[model samples]
Target chain A: MAVYTEVTDEELSAFIAQYDLGAVLSCKGIAEGVENSNFLVVTERGPYILTLYEKRTRKEDLPFFLGLMEHLAEKGIACPLPVAGRDGVALRELSGRPAVIVTFLAGMWPRRISPQHCAQLGEALARLHLAVGDFRMERPNALALNGWKDLFAKSAERADEVAVGLRTTLADELAALEANWPADLPAGVIHADLFPDNVFFRGDSLSGLIDFYFACNDFLAYDIAICINAWCFEIDGSFNATKARLLLANYRKVRPLSRAELDALPWLCRGSAVRFLLTRLYDWLNHPPGAFVRPKDPLEYLRKLRFHQSVRGLGDYFLDDSATGEA
Target chain B: MAVYTEVTDEELSAFIAQYDLGAVLSCKGIAEGVENSNFLVVTERGPYILTLYEKRTRKEDLPFFLGLMEHLAEKGIACPLPVAGRDGVALRELSGRPAVIVTFLAGMWPRRISPQHCAQLGEALARLHLAVGDFRMERPNALALNGWKDLFAKSAERADEVAVGLRTTLADELAALEANWPADLPAGVIHADLFPDNVFFRGDSLSGLIDFYFACNDFLAYDIAICINAWCFEIDGSFNATKARLLLANYRKVRPLSRAELDALPWLCRGSAVRFLLTRLYDWLNHPPGAFVRPKDPLEYLRKLRFHQSVRGLGDYFLDDSATGEA
Candidate 1:
């Protein structure tokens, strides 16, 4: 639902001529990816996605995102490859915003998260972490533990307005997470926001991963923790153990978690939940009066945060090797 | 910017199974056409547009709209042909909304209107009118002369809130238009809203016309009048006579306008302007708070209405048969 900048035909034509991708047939603003203006651009060469980086995406961090995609694609990971122009540059300017055209991947994001979908996602996530191992660039996770206190500070005053006891609960969770947040774990370029929408599936099979705007160097298991929070929750806010087991088991098969990483799963989940809750809480509080995008319900994440807080151990989240099997 | 209904994988897969088209590879909700929730759905078979009719479009009128597109496409007109399912039904339900899949046309709508573009548009439009002449379906234009007064009544109170004398001016214009509205003009299925965005172009050539939701049975020349208001106006709120002359002349080459039709052009243009002005005015005044779709400025059409009111005769609108060439 984001096509913030309108690219004129003349501007687009001039922009397209810089690349060898044939004459422009059509460029349709597509309702995909929330962070940028995405156009499903079709030329004689075929379909490509034209993404104009919006305000949320930093101009400086684009190279890291683009480079990561190019690197992963070269490593045989199914992802969008940045199409470089004749000047051998993948990134350029269009409509006064940084824009890039990437090869269109044919798949839909699975709307209903199934156990198999989570299993496939776990493999893809693990592969992504391993594939970007040799990539040179590094971007710090902006929504990680280090940034949470500042984010919490911004939304602390109005936090309770979203849910009763939300402010106090968030404060307690943040203090606990900060004290016990795991460090010195296997870190790499993690898709910080590997929500179901960001992971595309061709039927039940994982086709590709997208939306690299949130990709950053962080604890790879923390990425899994984010996924656990996002994917394992049912509509009723209950945790699905089978989905969690599949996600974790398949992920471990690809990239075995360290003992420290395994131990930190529940806390990481809590921290990840709080991270999203704080950001969503901030957005829910700060959105303009007539803004088109409805702020995602912060209470949903509050419920998830509460669930993670109640988890007795990693076993509750289906960490296979853990001593405790259930809460 | 309108994907009001979210179609889940289970729902979409079940829906796609009803059709003979290949398995659904991808379905991205496209940021085209404002009225409906449109998705650029791609499958193993190729690309198609999946339109879920939203609130604005009446469900009962879908048959006429779908039938018109099917009829026009069969007549060798370049437009999206509604793809019927195996049961030979084009219209069906998806995500609790009436939906249809149509063949995807592969060209972009011209962002900047050129004289050549207008010329091409005139010919295509004339051809469209002639092609749909024998089509059995008959849908009365909902925004015709009769509808204008009702629309005006809704917005009349706050009309002047937008402009100084908009209310009084609109009332007088409506009365004059209603009194002088033409009868017995060559009538057929007219694309009531043939705005530039509805017409697609590859370079200077017209590739296709789309969004037949607004197509209806109306005075044939009145469609041309709508076009004159739409394509022949410059961005600075002035009439481009050269563009008008090209459009009218090219249109006549395909479907000749009768003497009565030519004489009635000014009044038709005025009526068309009022029709749009009233609708835009209604939308402008009645727009709900925090509504996503911004109501188009009614002042733009008011300016066009004023221009049409000042028209002396067919000469002002560049009716080619008139002796006053190059005005």
Candidate 2:
């Protein structure tokens, strides 16, 4: 929950004047998105989300994020369309920060993830991969395999403060992932952080995907691995193969995975786990005392990493028969 | 900025089932109102504010706050009307706390207060006083004179921690206020916490008043005193008598202030200062480490109290000659 920047009334009016979105009716700071200040701005025209990019999001990377959303949206993907000003410039400035307004999507993110939600998410994820096939913009995933060691270095010294043996465990995992990371796979733009909170649903159907701040060019199969870790895990740390089967089966229906991509799933999942674990560990160790956002538990991803380390093959994730049949 | 309660989608849907508001389209936790979990709930019907009362707000007081808003709205005062469910009940349970949905008001609180904003606030405040004259429900101001000593006792030991001699200063001021507080002045339902954030404006006009949880029966002049301290102070701890003059002058145009009420202004302002000072001091000293909502600066009110201490009479706040003319 964050609203790091407070937009003054004068600043807001001047900012809104750039757009065709009528007189401002109300602009409220919304408790969403941890990295940026978000306002649910209502105007004479309609509701839109005005986001002021905070320091965490590099200014240079905003064009790729906004352009990716625009690109995917044009390809018939369900996502927030960046609303440009009268001059047709979507990216602008507000309160001394890079700002943009996007059309408000109507749906609530599923708090209790159901198998149906996983099914819908799988199809949508595959569609998103297919949609970005023709997009020209490219941004390498900054938190991918290449960045894990650097991230771990910052938190390694105090890792054991969170749990005993955590430092050694992370070091070993980082070495293993760095040595075995896959290079040959179907690559495209992937929603690197497609947690349940970022995917919204209206009833049983997927409504939209949001928060493209982490979108980047990476192995598309790795995106599925991220989803399997995010969606298939229960609160008690047990894996639900049924949800994984549905997610993978539905995803393959839209875009068939190559044989090599299927074989690399375990390693991708482990890499995905390390990516989150390292970031979460850094945040856990470094978050300011009395910070509004409670840093996510890094150990949860550690548990996921352990599960991935134990996996013998694809059979450990989903039944081969279920993959052939209807999910 | 707060969203203490995390309402699950299942719980939210079940809660909305009790209402005729169309299917839940979206519900985003908003960073507003420190005392409750507020969501900008948009449905098929329209937008509304779904507030889940936090622990700071007593369960028994829900009826008074909701009822007062309903009463005030019916009396033609622009405020959020508590929306009743299908069963004609506005108050219900959500996420195991008292909750109510109120019609959304469309306006933003002035981030930079101007004299015109003060004038609008003055007229709106007077109208609110007149509108609530017939309100049947009565709640004594819990943070008023009778409650200050007990509040001070909670923080007296550490008062000086905030500033040198603050403990003695508060103790002596409490005693003096207890001795001088007026007994026979105009009394009615007062929005005791009519801070700038609680009042909404569209351009230069007052659109509505909100956050009625602090509404209670008190001397009407004391409400003006609260506004004087809130809307008439500059950010640098300097008092703007021009803003005060515009506020009080416009307020009298709607409901004339009695000579006695005018005479009691200084003491009322001082008492109002103490009321906030003790509460803020208590919050400052008692808030848990790493709490999300930052405790407001108690010293700001200390400065305001000091300013009120130096004022000799109404002349110090405003010119009496301007009271009869246009603000």
Candidate 3:
């Protein structure tokens, strides 16, 4: 863990002094992440996560991450609400790192996920999309359609050595996406990395969500596609059709996807694959080591890229539309 | 870039104090990597990379990563050779981070990878395996066969959400693997993350190997299986038969695999897929807010896992060996 920030018990208790919900008690470092230093704070008050900023994070961006949580919390989105300090500020300086405090979510990450959970995730994700649409702030998708090309350019000089065909494929895909990019659809800020860990739950009911770093403006349906790739799969690398259906149906219960979005799911999934593959490929080629940060496996994205290359339809990835009652 | 260590001009001059290599020159940050910070050091001595240790590394393990580079460089491998500092130590520390200086490598990562490049990589990887046989060091395969279960356990609660039959299928594989784990294969340290990014080349020849964080003890043949999954496919995810053949055949030239090893590729590939999928799943569930790190696409592993699920012969993947050539 990277200790991006340092905070003390007295300061924390003082910070949360005004919040009527919990009593202040103890605080200690939990884990250090690339973006923030996380401390587990136990208050006679309650449990909260104290985060101090790291190098990669700019203090200016804290409000977006913090305020979004507060906004979502008010909307019944089941996320942590940013608690303000004594001066009514949501952030503070600790260990020379930007710091903030938020409530800790409950629920163990599902290890042996069931297809039902996949379906539920899909539904819950749809709900998230609907709920957050009303939030006042907006952020454009930083990793939207053309992001892959920029990453490729960053590593293109050495693309040939990584593999012979990668360059040509990247070029071709860039062209294909450009030519076929979606122009109009439901738009909103999305929790782009809506995989299992970011979501917390108590039993079958969701408790909260964490990690809003990748949250940005993008297609509403694309977020669902990300969920399909993330939530509807088991640890064994197998896709569960039932769970995928459950997910889709659940989403429909909230804000139904438009036909354009529904029709675009397959292509969007491909884009999703491309997005991750490029980043993974970039990291692999660069091998930039950081403090306490581990490079993820690029092969997984490679496999996904390949699978999407051979995709026939979104139905194949999900099940038939009959999956959800909306069909 | 995190400056883990620095050899100021004065320090370099004093150290070379004795060596008379060249002029103390400019040190600049290199734009590469998601993990460690690197600098391109230009001295009358030549160009080198000054790396700062970050989070996912232990300084003590430098011997393994650095020594492997030396051993490979000594054997005509075109890789960075760890240079000793003024104190005659191969490593130095700056900014409280472990640091090392290495020669800069030149090459382009292949964009349109050809069968030839794949074949060459296969051959080169084989040579690497052979060279490491006498590594004179021992490191456990931290992510090998049985280790996948622990990763799955780390996030199995949501396993069912992935695929319908994933849980049961994994259960059966776990039992089968446990009951019939291969023990009598050629064992050695392997570059487990031998994906395209790790290998650099000028044209079709490999130039350097960077990032050895995942290298560990495991069956050498398993490494080959990993290569097939990585090198045998096109960017669009299609399996290139010729590429697969070239990779396998060239690999065999340096390290001929036994029948038992051949039979184990499917299981090994499956295990590899499982290993990556589990790690990726864990990351997906646990991303930190505002981290620059991008999560890998789990679908790729899902596809690879599916392919391995149905494997019945070497032919199924792409191995047709004859006494003379690849059958």
Candidate 4:
């Protein structure tokens, strides 16, 4: 059902056959992704994963995704490493789609993000930030501050369709966000989509990470902002102070955030939430029937944007009440 | 990508080949919409849209979506109806997706919702509920009660990850909701996802309704609850009473709400917000990356739920002295 692309098994087998994985034993499509075709492959040498590029993901960007995984894995990050062919290439075409073979990783994404899990994820993310430091690649953030305006342009015609004054409000926010976007800050490779689902764990212990499709060079603090929006809030849109604290505290353990990063968290969170909301709205209005996917309720992201909007401070939400209230 | 599955070039040629003709053309990969798959099928028959197999729409139920359009069209609804195929079937399968071909709808989803737009949507939805009464099909009101708990069960394993008392709080609310489930009230098919994207418009006039996937027999008041959540809230998750009132006032002009329905609106809104939050939460915690859809943050809904939960009295949010304070 997740077959958004036309990649077939035979095509993948032939593609990997060139990789000299020793010998291919079995290939099973692992329906673990909603955006791309993923498979578990066992070869004479070891187990690996074969990924067939799909829409949201471009085949040309396979090097960024595959290479990041390999770099992270080599640097002691627990993640899938794209295995190279005898010719030292990590990517090949299969079934009319770009494909790659990588070592398969284990551990389930935390279904329940406990305080401990929050702390663990925070630390893991920090470590990841540290680990990606040595990755030699240059990719601008795809969904960065400017991306919001681009999405808004697509949805402008229908912004009013979502709510009264949405377009005007969005326009105003765009101005405000633009006015406050952090200009000088530490930048590095970031796993932009670091939600619980993209993480792995074993018995309360962090296992590995996957999906660097949104990975990009951006403010480290911006990545933290994404996590805040992703992790601390509940579906009903209520902010849980404890969960927020756990996440921030754990992250600071390994990679302490700068004062500037701390100050930028609320704006970054707003940008992140609105970014997702705008995309959802655009898709909601523009979705094609043959869409292999369902559009999520953009209102959910709208709520998140609204929450960050009210947040003049991220202090009490995480560290101390007085300082956060002031922010 | 907007495949005209409801009516292919061949089918349209057969059906409208007899009617006033424009250039006949079709797109491929139409979305299997809940209410309709929109096809921009230009025909010498004049540009028209073709929708097929309105979903949740039984063969017998097609009359609701189809008939509603026809009825509204007669009353100047500005929407096309199910054009019969030459084979006499109004709905048919083409391009591996079900569809129907009708005149293409003009206008765009409004971007700036004013109190006016909210009021307009409110009136349009009520009018829709009233216009469809000529066709009768009985379906139960879902999201009535216990619906919240049922959803929670899907993510029950991780309830505690947020707080120690979420499970108990959710359980308590579920019990109360079940105890208070409305048994008898005005009933009809309601457009459940009436968020801005579903309503189309030109200038200030409402054009048509699309995406009836969630339409079903439900309490008219419950539909109002959905509107409250959809229209009366800002992106920051704050309640906008002025917009809510405008919506209700406009809706009442067309289909006046019963006093009982009004009494149920607050509970219904809470339930509506809760439903979205829980679904989003389920998606957030367990997204299979290949789904091509993004999972929304649950926190937004949670925030809305909190506001609803703390409504010591509903009158206060509306500036109505009679409804002020949490009930």
Best by DockQ: 2
Which pairs clash in the backbone of model 1? none
- Sorted on DockQ, best first, the list reads 2, 1, 4, 3
Relative to the true structure, candidate 3 reaches a TM of 0.48
Give the DockQ (2 decimals) of all models: 0.68, 0.80, 0.01, 0.03
* Candidate 2 ranges with C-alpha deviation above 4 Å: A321-327, B321-327
Better of 1 and 3 by DockQ: 1
C-alpha positional error of residue A58 in candidate 3 after TM-score superposition, expressed in Å: 3.7
Query: Which pairs of residues collide in model 2?
Result: A290-B290
- Give the better candidate number (2 or 4) by lDDT: 2
Best candidate according to TM-score? 2
Runs in model 3 with CA error above 4 Å?
A6-25, A32-34, A159-164, A234-237, A287-290, A322-327, B1-327
The residue ranges of model 4 lying beyond 4 angstroms of the native Cα positions read A6-9, A22-25, A44-46, A316-318, A321-327, B1-327
Q: Which ten residues in a row have the lowest lDDT in candidate 1 chain B?
A: B318-327
Candidate 4: lDDT of A317?
A: 60
- Candidate 4 reaches a DockQ of 0.03
Tens digits of per-residue lDDT, candidate 2, A186-297, equal 8999999999989998877899999999999999999999999999999999999888888988898898887788888999999999899899999989999878887889
lDDT to native, each model: 0.86, 0.90, 0.68, 0.68
Worst 10 residues of 3 chain A by lDDT: A25-34
Shift of residue A195 alpha carbon in model 3, Å? 1.5
Give Cα distance to truth, residue A296, candidate 3, Å. Answer: 0.5
* Residue-wise C-alpha lDDT for candidate 1, range B5-33, written one tens digit per residue: 79987788889999998899888888766
Q: B104-212, model 2: which lDDT tens digit per residue?
A: 9999999999999988888899999999888899998888877999999989999999999999999999989989999899999999999999999887788999899
Rank ordering of all candidates by TM-score, starting from the highest: 2, 1, 4, 3
